[model samples]
Target: MLIYHPAFDANHCLYRIVSILHSANKTGVSWSLLRLLDFYYLFPAQLKEISPWPSQISKYKRLLKNIPQQYEDINNSPRVFYDLEKFQKTAVLELIAKGIVSKESFEADKLCLVDDALPPSFIAYMKSDEFFNKDEFKIITEALPMVGLNGPQGLKKRSGLMEYIYDA
Candidate 1:
C-alpha cells in the first residue's frame, strides 16, 4: 500500500524550508524554531489556534480571517508534530547537501541560508504569489517576531506540541 502525503514529501518539505529560511532573512532561524515554524507552515489552521496573539489582535485580523476552512483544526497536534520530525530533519539535511544551507551553520544550531547558493529564479518564485499559499506564508512571517519573544520553549508550551519542561 503506497502512501503519498505532503508531510512525507521530500521536495515539498525542502521547498517549504527554503521559503522559511528566505523569509527569515539574514539572522537565520534556530533548528528548534525552524521545526516549530515549519509546523505552522504546514498546518496554518493550527497556527491560528496556537499562536500567541498580540494585545492588538487587529494586526492579524485580516490574515486570520483569510485562512480557508479547508484546513480544519488539528486535534492531535503533538502526535502529528512528532511524527513529522524525521522528515523535517531529512529536508534540512537535503538543504545542506544541496549547498543551499551551510552544514557548519546548522551544526552550530542555526540554519543559515548560503549566500548566492539559491538561483535568483528560485528566490523570485519564493517571493512571488506563485509560492505555496500567500496568506499562509504571510502568517508565518507575521509569527516570526514571536520567535525572539518566546524562543523554542515558550513556543512549544504555547503550541502544546512538545515536552519543553525538560528541554535545556
Candidate 2:
C-alpha cells in the first residue's frame, strides 16, 4: 500500500519553507532555527508543548487556547526531523535554483528570501486564512524573535532535535 506523509513531500516542504522565510522577512533566519520552526509548524502539538511561550506570546492567544488537540508525536519528532532532512534540503535547493531564495545566505548558514516580495498569488495564499491555519501561522511568526534570543547552537540545544554539543 502506498502511503503519503507531509514530511516526505517536497512541494509541501517548499510551501512551508516559503511561508517561514516570508514570515521572517528580509532579516532572514538561521538554518537551524528554520528547521526547528519548520518542525513545529508541521507538528503544532509538539510546538505548543515546547514553545518558549512567555517570551513569544501571540496576539491570537484565544486561538492558541482553543486550538484543537493534535497528535503529539514527541517520541518520533527527532526521527521525523531527520527523515524530513533530505526533503528540506531538496526544497532549499529547488528554491535556490529557482532564484526565489538566496544561495549565498544558505551557504552562510541562513535562509533569506531573494525577492523583496513574493508573487502576489503566493502572498495572497500565504496570508489567506483559507489556505493555512492562521492561528498557527501567527504563532510561528510571533516566535521568530526567539531566533535572536538563541543562537543556532542554543536553539538546537533547546529543541533537543539534534545533538548540538559537537555541531560546528
Candidate 3:
C-alpha cells in the first residue's frame, strides 16, 4: 500500500518496514532488500509515489545487496507469533530505545538472521477503518488519480483536501 504515496521517502519507508521485520517470529525466511522493495512497490499504492527512474530504483536494489539485514542471531526462538527483535537496527533501536542492544549479544558476536515477515502491527496501522467500506472507498478511489502519488496532491486526497485540490 505504500508505493505511490507521493510523499514516500525511501529511507523512511525502509526504516518502517525494517521495524516490522524486527517484530516477526518466522525463522525460515529472510528478506532480501530487493525483494522487500519489490513487495512495497508491488502494490499499486506503493508505486504511486515512486519515481519512475530506473537508476533511482536500481540504487536501492544495490543497497540491499550491500547493507546488513540481520540484527542478531536467535538464541531461542520466541513462541510468540512476532519476534520484534528480528528487525531492529542500531539506528532504529536508538531512536525508540527499549534498551539498547543486549551488551552480551554484542560482545558474543553471533551469526544474525535476516527477518523475512512484515509486521502485522504495522500493516494494521496502515489500514483504515473505511478500508472496505463502500462510500469511503469510493471517495479514496476517486481521489488517487488527480496527481498519482507525487506530492501534496495525493496527500490532499487522503487528507480531506481532495475537494479543494480538485476544485482549485
RMSD of each: 2.9, 3.2, 19.2
Report the C-alpha lDDT of model 2 over 1-168, residue by residue, as the tens digit: 997767678899999999888876567777767787788778765654544444334444455665556754456778988887888888989999999999899999889999754788878878784426566666666554454435443556556576766664
Q: Report the number of the highest-TM-score candidate.
A: 1
Better model by lDDT, 1 or 2?
1
Best by the lDDT measure = 1
Question: TM-score of predicted model 3?
Answer: 0.21
lDDT of 3 by residue, 15-99 (tens): 4443333332222112222122223221323323333323323333232333233333324322211222233233333432333
Q: Residue by residue across 33-84, what tens digits does model 1's lDDT show?
A: 8887788887877766655554433466467777766434467888888888
**Cα-based TM-score, every candidate:** 0.83, 0.80, 0.21
Candidate lDDT values, in order: 0.74, 0.71, 0.31
Per-candidate count of clashing residue pairs (backbone under 3 Å): 0, 0, 13
Whole-model alpha-carbon lDDT for candidate 2: 0.71
